[model samples]
Target: MRRMLLTFCLLSLLPVTYAVACLWDSETLEQERNKFPGTLEVITGNFPRHSPAFYQWRLDDRLNKLANDPDNDRWLDDVAVSYEKLGRHSEAIEVAESQLQRNPDRYETLANLATFLIHDGQWEAGLRYIDRALEVNPDAHFGRERYQRLLVQYLLQNFPDGQVEYPLAAGDRIDFPTFLVNDQPPGEDGQPPKLSIEQRQAAVQGVVGMMRFSQHDHPVLLEVLGQLLTETYRPKVDAKQLAARCYLLLADSAASPATQAAYEQLAKKSLNLQATHKSGSEGQMGLRAVRRELSGELAAAKKRYNSIVLKEKRWIASGVDVEAAYRQYVNSVQW
Candidate 1:
């Protein structure tokens, strides 16, 4: 308990900054995206979750603003977003389509409309729009649209008969590697080629996009987040410990007791694997202390999430770039 408190204090003092790769400025961030042509670099810190009442208020507010100034098409995006949040995808689709008709080449409208279509279960239509959005501005949103494209392809491969469901939860239902690899040839050593940085970025982007637009704690996205972090990489935190936390969160949020146990077991396996890896610094803290620190970080993150999201006051961002703890939670743990 004392160690946990001390760890919490250390975490509390840490700055609440986002990953360097995900700075909110689109133009400046695009410079980073250019380095990796097709991969996504999601700021996951931009799209904060809001209550339905909050979205309704936003929708009403935007509608009023548009009423006063009919030429302001930007508000249309907000209106569509609000409708999407309220689970009125048909209305969202209409608003987005109207905007698209006015500005067919606008990447934001195209991308937003595509996502709305996907959420509405029009996968093919969404995929087509996504392709068009990419053609207009391939690097928009740090190349996030590509990840959406990849997701559509993945889902289509699984349910090829054109009948599918929304908010997909893979949950041990598919072999991820087989689908992701697309039958690529093995390496010269006869083993599968290691995952490229682009592939990892795409996977991370998929998870972020899902959490932002779909369900926040969707089990499948959480599992993918865990799997991605498990790959060897230098991160702000221990990768396996972070992966373990992802699995634990999956277990907690899982709908079934059996699923919970399965994730809990995965978490244990992640922890046990930690012992096999020698302390990288050759003199850093032991594995136990690292796990303790991870626990403190996760607890602090949950506290921050609750503090940001549990407010009674009606709130809306003053601008699209506004920061919220809800958005940073995914970055805090996953990055």
Candidate 2:
């Protein structure tokens, strides 16, 4: 009876032990060995030299012979990258994994494999390989940078704020012109009409949402939002209110006292505009509440903001239809 009980206990502990082993061990490379079938159809169709298909053919020809040569390992990396660039992600992953089977300590191969996996939307699994690569060579700069980039990409995508399709990278700065459509007249030679204010707002909102969720501070994103508010002409939208909201968002990520103060000044200008405007009562009240919140009157501001939110179900909210109110207020002040 004692022997049987001991055997059963040992059997039960096997899975737990294995899980623990897998957790601490950098043997994912070993476990992934032979996981993917070693078969890929390389298309050799002729195309322009600059085309991906031409690059694929060239790489495929080299890979066929290089796969057998253990000394020429770097060529294998090139082939894998080319396969990825050509949208042959599965083949890229297979090539990378095969290379790892022969040379498991190749940090570059490991990093490349991680990137391929991430590109294929297998980020969690890919991150394990990144950690393994960094483990093998902590000083691998490319590997480390790739790992951080992947991490940021994952965070931006999975963040609760909003879904973003843009591929973000470190030191990546987007200019305002990139968001603007060409100046061609609408319907001339089939040219599309200019993007509406709502469309621009949506685009800017997507960017701000990503920045809001990003773990890393993004002053560039805040600056871009600020610039958009100041530069864009949306006749209906109250730019001041938008500026105030942007300033509040920027405050969270501001790195210096000067930056914070600048945001505060901008917020104050927006608040003053809202308070002085002869707009709808609800809009004025909402703006006052936001100002109060910014000015450290949190309890009253929260109550007012909450009341506005509760009333949103029945009426156009504070910020909506703000353009008409803005024009009315401006005309009133001017007259």
Each prediction's TM-score versus the true structure: 0.65, 0.33
Model 1 per-residue lDDT tens digits across residues 192-279: 7556666766666666666666665555556666666555322322245545656776676677787777777767655542332344
Clashing pairs in 1: none
Q: lDDT tens digits, residues 1-335, model 2?
A: 99999987887777642322212111321231112111000000011112343345547556777868845767887788788778789999998999888889888898788878866767666778878887888755522333244333444344424333221111343334233444446666674555566654554444444343221124444444444444322324324444455566565446667666666665554444233233444333244445443455334434543543344322333434433443354355421
Q: Clash pairs of candidate 2?
A: 236-323
lDDT of 1 at 103: 86
Give the Cα error of residue 97 in candidate 2, in Å. Answer: 1.1
lDDT of each: 0.61, 0.49
- Report backbone clashes per prediction: 0, 1
TM-score for candidate 2, residues paired by index: 0.33
